[model samples]
Structures are given as structure tokens and as C-alpha cells.
Target: MSKEWFPLIDEDKCIGCLACYNKCEHGVYDVENGRPVVVYREGCIDGCHGCGNLCPEGAIIYSGEYKEHIKCSCGCSD
Candidate 1:
């Protein structure tokens, strides 16, 4: 099956601009530790491609579930 894009944020790089938070329609990004964090990542778009591009600090990434989600529990069919 085809994988999907997830949200991610780099704490060190994030400038806490909230630009990404304001732009995202999915409500996936949030503020934490003075940085934008991908909180509701799994509920984010399965094909979401809008958040990462707008980040001025380039803190966002589309990888798995929250970009850091490296483990596989995708509930897919065999």
C-alpha cells in the first residue's frame, strides 16, 4: 500500500512563528517549548502537503505520523 505524509517540527529550528499553525487547515500543528509541534499529526491529511512548505524556518516535514513516527502500526491489509 502507498504510504502517507505526516507532520513534523524541529524544536531547535522552529522560531515559534505560528505561521505554520495559522496556515494548517487540519489543526495538526501546535506550540510547545517555544516551538511549533505537530500535535494532531495522525489526524492530519493522509496526503497532507500544505504545512511543511509554508514554514519559514523549515521545521515541518512530511514523513510518517509526526515525521518522527518511525515505527509501523499503519493498520493496513496484507
Candidate 2:
């Protein structure tokens, strides 16, 4: 987990969907009033965007510099 890596949810864009909450396996998110919050930011994995990818409303945006070395869902690391 990286301290600089975490998901930032845009409340205006969020529809209170639990997509991010259910997608995160690192205990990085928590539900409050039906919306997902980044309660455990330090728990977020470095270069991991699983939660953001699963968000339908594109409400989740990750911090830190984008890493191109990480592998994609298609198994391509570019």
C-alpha cells in the first residue's frame, strides 16, 4: 500500500453506488449514507485502479502519478 495512492470520490458525480465499495479488496473504502468513502487511504495498493475501473459513474479518481508499468486487465503491461 502507498500513502500517495487512494481513490477520491466526487460526490456530485457519485450516485451513491457501491461499486467502489464492493470492488476494493484492500479495505480502502467504506459506505456512509449509501456512498463510498476512502476511509483507509493508506490501504490502497500502489498503482491499483480496480475500484475506479469498476465505478460506472466515473466518480472515483486516483491520486499519485500514473504508472504505465502496471498491467492492464488484458494482461498487457505497457
Candidate 3:
């Protein structure tokens, strides 16, 4: 399997602070489950520049290729 380039957010760790959205100007982040989720995925493989780093609880992650680094509630990281 090949790796798909994209960044993702951990919704569970997200406190609905919209930090990724507010932090990025690419509109790559959006509100999901009251937290910020990766909406626009394009040329965002390396991650949202600093979206994951801004996360307080380290919910955001850059998983392996072909996998989604963004995670949702229930401790699931795609």
C-alpha cells in the first residue's frame, strides 16, 4: 500500500478550541464533534504546519503514510 499525504487532528483531545482553524490560514481545519477537524485536505501531508503542535493534550498526530493522522473521539486516530 502506498502512503497518502495528509494531516489529521485528534477530535477527542480537542477541546473545541478551534486552535487549528484559528492557527491555520489554509482553512484546512473545521469544527467536528464540537472540536476542530480536518476538512480541507490537499497538499497538507506534512501536517497543518503547526496545528498538531498547538494541541494542548497532544491529541493531534501525524500517523504513518496511507493512514490518517487526524483522530476523532474514542481515542481513534485514522
Top candidate on TM-score is: 2
What's the lDDT for residue 17 in model 1? 86
**Per-residue lDDT tens digits of candidate 2, residues 11-35?**
9999987988887777888988877
Candidate 2: Cα lDDT at 39: 96
lDDT of 1 by residue, 5-47 (tens): 6666777787888877877766677777666777776556564
Q: Write the per-residue lDDT of candidate 3 for residues 6-77, one digit (tens) a residue.
A: 566665666777766777656667776677777776635432336676667777676555433453322223
Best-first order by lDDT: 2, 1, 3
Count of clashing pairs, candidate 1: 0
Q: Tell me the RMSD of model 2 versus the true structure.
A: 3.5
**How far out, in Å, is residue 54 in model 1?**
0.7
The segments of candidate 3 whose C-alpha lies over 4 angstroms from its true place after superposition are 1-3, 43-48, 64-78
Off by over 4 Å in 2: 66-78
Error of 2 at 68 (Å): 9.0
Poorest 10 consecutive residues by lDDT, candidate 3: 69-78
TM-score of 2: 0.78
